[model samples]
Target: MPCIPRLSAPHFLSIALAAASFGAAAQQPQLSAVDLARKNACMACHGLVHKQVGPGFAQIAERYRGDAAAPARLADKIRNGSVGTWGRVIMPRQSLVSEADAQVLARWVLAQPQQQQPPAR
Candidate 1:
């Protein structure tokens, strides 16, 4: 008969700690669209409700509403960058963002509530 070797208390505790740490990392929450935007520095030139160096997210949503192709177009713009669409302010290419993530971000931007325009005097 073969006998199994038993681990010492210290070795057992070390193995448990390593397993716990691995589980903690694996169970970490996924980043939301807003969080992803911040992580990728999208918030630097854009805002949720107001324009900064770029148009607000709500504004983009309003502009693209009912346009079925907007999602794909926006996603392309996000990954490859765009120029002159919103005047001469060029949107630099975000090569770091994966295609799937860019699509997620585009959908998120397009899902923002439409901003109310001010009444003309």
Candidate 2:
């Protein structure tokens, strides 16, 4: 006969607590950036990873890596519109998207993971 080990009370309590925490987290609303982007139609031109009409958020992050002022600059670009920076595609001025929202979106983009290029020999 195979013997089965019984879980201790402390172990069971910890498991229950972890499950509850996970459930709570799962019930929380989507990240603010995602919600804002969805509400403003930003996803129509930009994606988290792959390129849409504009460069991917990750690519933007990579391009501005190590720049301390990137967030502020990106926020300005979001509001004022930019062209010739990423080909002939023109980013129309987002007058509807508030400055605060633009800042939040820029921060979110900067937080995304950048693709690491392999080191050259």
Candidate 2: misplaced stretches above 4 Å?
Answer: 1-31, 116-121
User: Model 1's lDDT to the true fold?
Assistant: 0.93
Looking at candidate 1, what is the lDDT of residue 73?
98
In candidate 2, position 47 carries an lDDT of 80
Residue 21 in model 1: shift from native, Å?
1.6
| lDDT tens readout by residue for model 2, 56-85 | 989898889889999999999999999988
- Give candidate 2's whole-model lDDT: 0.90
TM-score of every model versus the real structure: 0.79, 0.69
Quote the RMSD, in angstroms, for model 2.
12.6
Clashing residue pairs in candidate 1, if any? none
TM-score, candidate number 2: 0.69
Q: What is the Cα-based TM-score of model 1? A: 0.79
> Which residue ranges in model 1 land beyond 4 Å of their true spot?
1-5
Q: Which candidate is the best by lDDT?
A: 1
